[model samples]
Every structure is written in C-alpha cells, then in structure tokens.
Target: MKKIIFFHLLNDYSGSPKVLLQVIEAVAKKGFEAELYVGGGAEGGFLSSAPCVQKRYFYKRFENKYLTLLSYSLSQLILFIKLLRYRHASAIFYVNTLLPFGAALAGRVLGIQVIYHIHETSIRPRPLKLFLRWMVERCSSENIFVSHFLAKAESFTNIESRVIYNSIPQNMVSSGANHVYPYASGNKFNVLMICSLKAYKGVNEFVRIADLLSGQQDIEFNLVLGASDSEVDDFFSSVTLPDNLTIISRCKDVIPYYQRASVLLSLSKPEEWVETFGLTILEALSFGVPCIVPPVGGPVELVSEDKEGYLIDSNRVEDIAAKLAFLHKNPEVCFRLSEAARVKSLSFSVDNFESDVIEVFNGV
Candidate 1:
C-alpha cells in the first residue's frame, strides 16, 4: 500500500492539528498507510493517539521567521536524507501548513507528490507570502485550502487548488438540550469566549464587553483561555474583571463549556489578523449555541447574520453589548437562532470532509 506522510507544524490540539488527525483518518480509510512528521514539540498531545498513525517523527524546531529560508533549506536536506529509504515506496508528503517548507522540497527531490494544506489567511510580510507562493508553484502537486477566504487570499491562480471546509467528527459534535436562558428561570445567562489570549483574538474586547454588561445581574460572563494561569494573570494584571465574570486558565476538553454556553463570542480583530476559519464558532453552532463574530475572514462564511448568529462590529463595545442584550431579552429569537445554527453546522461533517480529501488524494 502507498504511504502518506503528514508534516505537521504544531503538537497542540488546535484547529490545524485536529484537521491533520481527520486527514490521517480519511487517508487510512482509503487503504493507505499514514505517518506523522511533527516539528518542534514533544510527543504528547492530540495526534499521539491516532489509531491510523503508523509511526511518528519529531524534527528540530524551525519556527523563527528571520531564518526561514535557512531553516527550510536545512529541514529539507534532513527530510530528503530520511525519506531516501522510502524512495521506492508509493508515498506522498502532506504539508499541513506553509511553515514546513521542507516537505515540498523533500517531495520534489524524492520524486514524490506533495499536497500543501493551507489554514492561514494572514501571512505577514509580503515577501514571505510571495516565497510561499513560489514554493507551492514549484514544489507542491496540489494545494488545498480550508475556506474560500484563504483560497482567494493565496491568489495561486495557476496552481491546482481546492477549498475543503474543515469539519468536526460526528462523535465530537455536542448534542442534547440547549442551555436555558437566564430570564426564563432567574439563572445567569452564560456568555462564553474560548480562545487563546492574543491581542488579535480580541481578548480585550471580550473583557470590555464583559465590563459594559456587568450592570446586568442576570448575565454571567465566562472566559476559557488557551493560555496558562500565569500567562493569563500577567496579561490581565491591569484589567479589572467584573464580579459576574469568571476565568478558566485552560481545559483539555471544551465540550462542557460548549454545552453550558448560551452564546459564544469570536470577536477577532480583522485588521490585526484574518481568521482562516473559526473552528470554535462551528463547534458552538454544533452545540446549538449561536456566535457573534466579526464580519471578516472565514467566520463570515460560517455565520449568517441574525440567523445562525450575528456578525457585529467587534471594535465597538456598545454594538456587541446591544447584540448580547438583544439575545438576552428575546429568548424566542435566541431559541430560533440556536436551531438555525445547528442546521447550519450539519453541512460541515467529518464524512464530507474526508470524502473531499480522498478525492484530492485520488486525483493526485
């Protein structure tokens, strides 16, 4: 059988890593042997336990952008030597992100096919984007994007490209009764924000919104960070949190939070960063929880304004507060949006994602 080697950039259980796991599972079901070549981190996280993963390899860190060209050259040289033993095997290199410039080079040198799966819409410095485009044009046999937003951003007009929307596994999708609104039972309405503590992710906006709505005793704000306790503490040292606001440093599983949330917020700053695709928004949708995202980037594609969720001006605290207040006041409208969100989420299923991936591999 043919061997498919995936070059992953991170060991964290984030969007890209989860996509890698899904791709590996998809390829395996198609009767191909799969292996993962991870960069930088240690061998524990979400990818370690994949039943479809035949073997795993950890390479030296190549994260510094200042030395990207040098790092790419060295990493490619190493990969070329390592893959020499599998030269005769029917194999392909599946590059998870643009960071692993080595995978394309190694595949080109080894006379193997390379598929570049792009999940980033924001690639800083025009030169880096140009370099990535040049590499993809020269090395990769196929390019797959997670959304049309990213595909359009890449502008790889000549290369063979496909936009395969990211998906969550059926088993992983949240199911059961949606959370009851606060006004109905004198309970606190839960407004949840689950994201990394980054400036571009609008962590400050979330805090600001929480402060703006602190006067409402019935509404409770919750923040689940992807950062450590100390990191969050250092970041939020100056900012004051309201009495109704609660912070959780991190969570191995976000399902419980999803189940508990009345509404999810992805107030990412469009000017600072372009979200390739908001996986958490979709996750919230699967749980019948509507989201409020900025009307930019991939989240725009996922949400329907005032239907599945609202796309508000994330910069204005008052605008966000209004939307939250609207949802809180109109429980019937909130319930309708919740049902609409679940319906919208059905289109992004793991089976569909896998099938699309398999078609790409088969075509290659």
Candidate 2:
C-alpha cells in the first residue's frame, strides 16, 4: 500500500479544515499511515494543535497578503518534496482553496497522486479554475465532495468525484437527555441554531426566529455561534435578545447542546452560500434533536418533510415562527421528528465515513 498524505494550508478556522482533520484522525486510528499536510504557527488557525497530525515546514502565523501567498506556495513545495522523498507513489490531498499555478505544476512534477477534497459552494474563476481543472482532469485522481450538489456542480470536469458526507461517531453523540433547565422554562421546547453570524449563514433570520418565538410560554431559542469576522463578532456582541432567547457562545462539545435542543433551526438563504452538506443538521439529528431547515441547498439532501427534520417552505420569518409555534403547540410532533432524526443520523456515523474514505483511497 502506498503511503497517503492529506494536504491543506490555511489560517482560517473553518469547517472544511475540521472535516479534513477528522478524515486524517479516522485514517490514523485505523492504523493507516497518513500525513496531514497543514501549515502551523498561526495561533487561532485550524492547523494549530491538530491532534494526530504532523506539522510540516514553516507554518508560523502568517497574515499580510503577499506573505500569505508566499506561505501557501512554500508549504506546498515543501510538502511535495517531502512526499516524493517518502517513497510513496500515491497521496491523498485535501484542499479548501485553489493554489498558485506554480504549486500545482510542482506537484505533477513530483509524481504524487493527489485527491482534491472540495467542501464549499463557492468557486474561483480565471487562472485558479483553469489550474484546478488541469490538476484534476489531467491528473487522473479522485475528487471528494461533501455533498452531491457540490459533486454535480463539478460534473463538467472529466474527473470522477464522489459525495461522502461528514460523519460523527455514535458514542460521541449524546445518548441521554440531560440538563435543559438553564436555557428553557416550563415545557418550552428548545430551538438550537449553531452557526456563525455571517451573511451566508442568514444570522438575521436566526434572530427573527427567536423574535417570533419570543414570549412563547413553551419555547426558547439557544444560539451557538462562532465568530467568523470581527465585524460580525462585534455585531453579535452589541445585540440584545428577547426574553424567550438564550444565546450561548461557548461550546467545545456541541453534542450536549444538540441533545438538549428540541429542534435545530437552519435559516440560511439561497442554496449556494448557506450549506454544503448540512453538517450541523447531521449533528443535531444524530442526537435525536429534530431540525427545522429553510427549504434550500444541500440540506434538501438531508431534510425531508416531517422525517429527519421539517423542511419549511420559506426563509421568511413568519413561516419559520409559524413552524416553531406548531412544534411547540404539538409536542408529539417534536418527539416524532426527534425519533426519526436520530434514526437518520445513525447512518452517517464516523465509522461509516472512515470506511468510505479508506475504500475510495484503496480503490475498493
């Protein structure tokens, strides 16, 4: 078996980096030898302190535009040379961003088989797309997508792409319903929305949903937010919530919050910017937390009407509020969605993810 390497070099603490890391960790635990190629030195970046991942050369906290580009090229060149020197003919490369034209050419020169892992709805044009297509279409390797929608978008590429959803472990999923008092009151159902307050994430509708569910005797909205940018963080810092809402920014383990919530609210607008595979929705569903998602995007692949979660017709606040009101008024529906959600989520366990990814790498 050829040794495998996973490649990514970004200072952003984003979901795709975490997904790549999860794949690396899963492969490592299975006793497979794999190297996680990530730059380090940035204090708050995704690659910093990633467990079971070996830090390569010059990962030291980079910013400044030119330096960032320089850092990217240098890191890949180093990784490419390292892979060639390792006596491995095949390598699995995971990329969240497009590379400079030079780096792509260097990888081909190194004779390393690269697997491009794309986890976003956004695409870069011009020389970037041309370079990426050349790398994938001409390289004769695998392309991994987090959702079918993403795979289909890249269908024009002659490269073979596969959709494998991100998975969470079954044991890590919360099994018991525990501790829900501090956030909610007397039979009020808990509605959870875990996302950064970005335009793409539709943060205002999250606020709107809370506003609609406001003053309800049987419902409270709990927000789990990560700071995407300083402006957004500042916006969240200044906001005041209604009496029916409780906003929590601290959650290292979201499964507990997932278990406590009666429903997960996804209010992201336009299928493209909002979601890729609905990873948060999967997390919620895994713990028997029913979800309410705006009818759009990759979430369509996961959410069905009254099944895993409710697919409300609109992103409008009234419709979302109306749905929440229904969930609150009829607790039976919540329980039913909860049960169904759990069953659906179990199919996406991390074990399944590991097996699928390994099989793809192994040509199984």
Candidate 3:
C-alpha cells in the first residue's frame, strides 16, 4: 500500500479540517499508512478525533491577522524541508487547501504526486492569491474541489480536477437517524445558524434577521459559532442582541442544535465569501430540518427553490424574517420541506464520497 502524507496549514474547528478529517478516515480504512503534518495540532477541533493516522504539529496559529500570515509562511518553509526528507515514489502528498504551497512545491521538485484539495476562493491579497493559483497550476498532479461552483470558478486549463461534494460522516448520520421527525421542541420554532465567527460569513445578517422577528414570541433564533466565549463577546460587544436570539460558542456537539432546529440558515455573503458546499446545511437536512440558504454559491446547488428551502438574499432582513415567520406559522409546509430535505441529503452519502476518493487514489 502506498503511504499518504497529508499537509494542512491550520487545524481548527473549520470546514477544511472537517473535510480533511473525513478524507483521512476514508483512506485509512482502506489500509493505507497515513500521517498528518498540520499546524496547531487540532486545537480540540474535529481532527483531534482523527482515527488511524499519526498526527504531527509544525506551527502555531495566532490571533493577529498579520502575525498569522507570518506564521503561515514560516510553516510552509518548514513543511517544504520536511517534505523533502520524505520524498519517495511510494508516498504521495495530499495537500489540503491552497495555503500549503510548501508541500506542493516539495512534491513537485521530488517528482512525487501531489493532490490539492481546494475548498475556498476568498484568499486575500490579489497577488498572493494569484501566486497560489500559479503553484497549483504548475505543481499539483490533480485537484479536488468541494463543489461544481468551485471547480468551474477555479478551473485550470491543463490540470485534472474532480468535484467531490462533502457529506455527513456515517457516525453523525447514524446518531441523527433515530431522532423523531422535527426532534425536540413542543411549540417553539427554532431557527439555527452554525458558522465560524467571521464577518463575511453573514454573522451580522443572521443577527439582523433575529432582531427583525423579535416580536414573534413563538419563534426563537440560535447562533452556534465555532469561536470562544470571549471572542464571541468581543465580536458582538458593539451590537445589541435581540431578546429572542441565543448565542452559543465553542459547542463541541452541534447535533443537538440540529435536532432542535426548525430551519437551518446559510447566510454567507456571495460577493465576499461564497460558501463552497454547505456542510452544516447537509447535517441539518439529514435530521429532517429544512434550510434557508443564500441565493448564490455552492449552497444553492444543495437546495432547490421552494422545496427543501428557499434561496434568499441574506442582506434582505425583511425577506428572511418573512420566510421564517411563514415557516413558523405553517406546520404543514415546514413538515413537507423537512421530508424533502431529508430525502435530498441521501444523495450525498459517505459511501459515495469514499468510493470516489478511492478511485482518485487508485488513479494516482
């Protein structure tokens, strides 16, 4: 069996790490010897629970943006040197995201195959983003994108690329499977939005929607963020929270939030940060919970208009509030959408994801 060397810049409670964790688990189950060279060593994120893979830390994450960038460049330099030491035909480099350019460069120089699993398009500093794209174009043997939207947007003329949509891990799916339809909550309509504490992720927009519908006592809003309590407080210090809205932070378990959700929300700003495959939306859908995603981006691909959920602009506070109000008032419509969402989620299954990944590995 060929060995797999996974390189990820940061290991936090984010989408990229979660997807890489799934990929590593799938590859390991197939009896491949795997090792992960990640920065910050999981930080109690999803990768902390990774199975059958040796974990190694190379750098630490910083709170300051400029310091983080400096640390990132340093990590890559260190990764380039480490990858050089492990250069062999039997070992392939699996670089997660566009940030780990050092491992990709090393693989390119050593004539070893490198696969780039790209997840985002919002890389800042136009020149730096262009440089990373150039690296991918020249160094990567193949590329894996999380959505059709991303694949088309970041297409290279010569590189072989594949779109493998992220799925709910089998363990997570099983845990939510036994839950009764519309699990928990008697008469209250629970609206939930789970995302990182980033402004471009539409955190403010979600808050605005909650405020707009504050008068509706039966409807409650929940924002489950992946940041610490202090960080959450600092972010919302200037803003006033609505009485009907509840803010939760650093929640290790989001399944309970999904179980109690009447409708999940994906309010990512398309212009600033297009959501390349909404994993949380899929998780909520698996639990028979419908969603209200943004009008554009990869999330639109997951949901059908007026079926599982509606596609509305997150910036339109009145429109979003109206949709939530309608769902809260109409039980039959909400139940119908929930059933559709559950059925739609079945298409993106772990079996399908693993099979596609195995094919990619074999081809390499």
Candidate 2 residue pairs that clash:
40-59, 41-61, 42-61, 188-218
Largest lDDT belongs to which candidate? 3
Best by TM-score: 3
Cα lDDT computed for each candidate against the true fold: 0.79, 0.65, 0.87
lDDT of 1 by residue, 1-364 (tens): 5678888755665678878888887887778778877755464556766656544344453346657656555655665566677667788888988877767877887798988999986677868777877888888878999889889987576678889999886666634234432223337678999887788888899988999898999888888887678878988899888887898875668877777788999988888788889989988888888889888889988998989888886798799888899888888887898888888988898778989999987775
**Over 4 Å off in model 3, which ranges?**
55-57
Per-model TM values vs. the true structure: 0.89, 0.80, 0.96
Please report, as a residue range, the 10-residue window in candidate 2 with the lowest summed lDDT.
Answer: 176-185
Q: Which digits, one per residue and each the tens of the lDDT, describe model 3 over residues 1-364? A: 7788888877677888899999999998898888888776546787777775555647776788788778878878887887777755578889999989998999999988889999988888778899999999989989999999999989988889999999888877997677666622767789999999999989999999999999988889999999999999899999999999999999888988887889999999887888888999889889888899998778888899989999998888789899888888788998899889889999999999999998988886
* Candidate 2 per-residue C-alpha lDDT over 1-364 given as tens digits, one digit per residue, 9 for 90 to 100: 5556556655444566667767776667667666655555544544454555565555443436567656756765675565556444554444443442223344566665556677755543345566666666665456788888877766545667778888764455545223222223345578888875565676777887787767776777787776544545566676776787766653455766765677788877764364667778887776677777867667888888878777774367788788778777777777777777777876777777988887876682
- Residue 152 of model 2, lDDT score: 78
Each candidate structure's count of clashing pairs: 0, 4, 0
Global CA lDDT computed for model 2: 0.65
